[model samples]
Target: MGLGIRALIMVFMTIFTLTSVANAAEGTATFYTPPYVPSSCYGYQNNGVMIAAASDAIWGNRAACGRSYRVRCTGATNQGVPQPCKGTSVVVKIVDYCPAGCQGTIDLSQEAFSAIANPDAGKIKIEYTQV
Candidate 1:
């Protein structure tokens, strides 16, 4: 194959990968402070920006530890402290697994959470893509 064709193939693959990731993430989002037991797949931390996802069929155990994703809150809140969505997005590292009975698809650290949302809003709808 020619160099130009090979480059085009690589670009197409990248776009396809990103599109798949974006479509896979469509659920609720919330934030939290750490210091929990067993730590996360990347070990423990009480501060800094990060996020967690469920260890279900969607994201396998410890598989997403070092990955980053761009998350965007897509709508206005109807719950505690209304934070109207501004379509802003933030990239966060995956550091842990979602807590049992957690209320969202992804749980972010306060720093990561505040990047795309107002601090007062406890939960919001979000769409994310791996980066």
Candidate 2:
């Protein structure tokens, strides 16, 4: 390959890698059973099944409300399931607080969790990005 062509390829590869890294964030996720209403951000209002609760790390004093995040399961958090990801992603709205002692970084609704990972896994490693 010509020197110029090789340099161009390297530049494009660098840009692509950086863009992917900038958009994704690693976190742990767990599913919560129904009765998703009466959220701390929205009281008794239904926000659909594609909803989640932000952990203290991203709660930002309730600033996370109404925000949407795209989440993909990366792996299982335990040996109960060696591979939990279904090779899909789910976009969920932040409608509540997961609290300081929340078991996961984001508490996803059962439907949302099932979209990305097996519900039986309970908790899984995830890659997410605000959208």
Candidate 3:
């Protein structure tokens, strides 16, 4: 390929990398167990291990099906103080859809959730990256 063409490709690659890095998102996380809300949405249930769900209002549960995300808890905050995070990251595959009033970046299965935060927290601030 010509030098000019090579340079153009390099520039495009750089732009793509930057754009993906920009997509790293922040949100809240929670988990559910057993018969997931809307149990019919299972993608790869793994007999109920390492499964996840996202809000139907955002990506529609099936859209994220088969995709996994690396989730890390940022902290807990009921008011405005951000506490120390659990510093754990776990990969969970999308396998179902959470029902109404489910406000979170992703809804993880009990196993996946416990891998990151103490489930007793109910909800926690989180940052996740698709890997």
Candidate 4:
């Protein structure tokens, strides 16, 4: 190949790799108010406010405990908060499980949720990746 074409191919390859690493799972999030103890994973130990509960989809049958995820608010899931995202992300440790009938992919503690979105949003669209 010509030198120019080879450079172009390399540039495309770099862009592709970068995009792959940046990809995150899209999901919904809801905030759970405290009394954040007696958790299924820790059992009454305080894991602090920057914690979340994984839904059944990500729970991995209790293996999710102690895992950390970086969650970013993508947008509002309901009309109640049309612009609820706070334009930031929060990292939270998995401290519990959000069992069956859970409304979101991850249930963030109220403090964690408010760090990335308006509390009034209640539930919001999110992009998350294990960190």
Better of 2 and 3 by lDDT: 2
Runs of candidate 2 exceeding 4 Å displacement: 1-14
Q: List the residue pairs that clash in candidate 1.
A: none
Candidate 2 per-residue lDDT over residues 25-76, each given as its tens digit: 9999998988998999999989999999999978999999999999999999
Least well predicted 10-residue stretch by lDDT in candidate 1: 49-58
lDDT of each: 0.70, 0.93, 0.74, 0.93
TM-score of each: 0.67, 0.86, 0.69, 0.84
lDDT of 1 by residue, 1-131 (tens): 69999999999999998877558577777887755324566454532545555434235667877677888888645745566566578887776787568777788777677878876777888887778
C-alpha lDDT (0 to 100) for residue 11 of candidate 4:
100
lDDT of 3 by residue, 10-119 (tens): 99999998987578688888888776544445533444577677776445536776677888888884666445356778887776766778867788888788888877
Task: Provide the clashing-pair count of each candidate structure.
Answer: 0, 0, 0, 1
> How well does candidate 1 match the true structure in TM-score terms?
0.67
Q: On a 0 to 100 scale, what is the lDDT of residue 72 in model 2?
A: 92
Cα lDDT of candidate 4 equals 0.93
Poorly placed runs, candidate 4 (over 4 Å): 1-22
Q: Which candidate is the best by TM-score?
A: 2
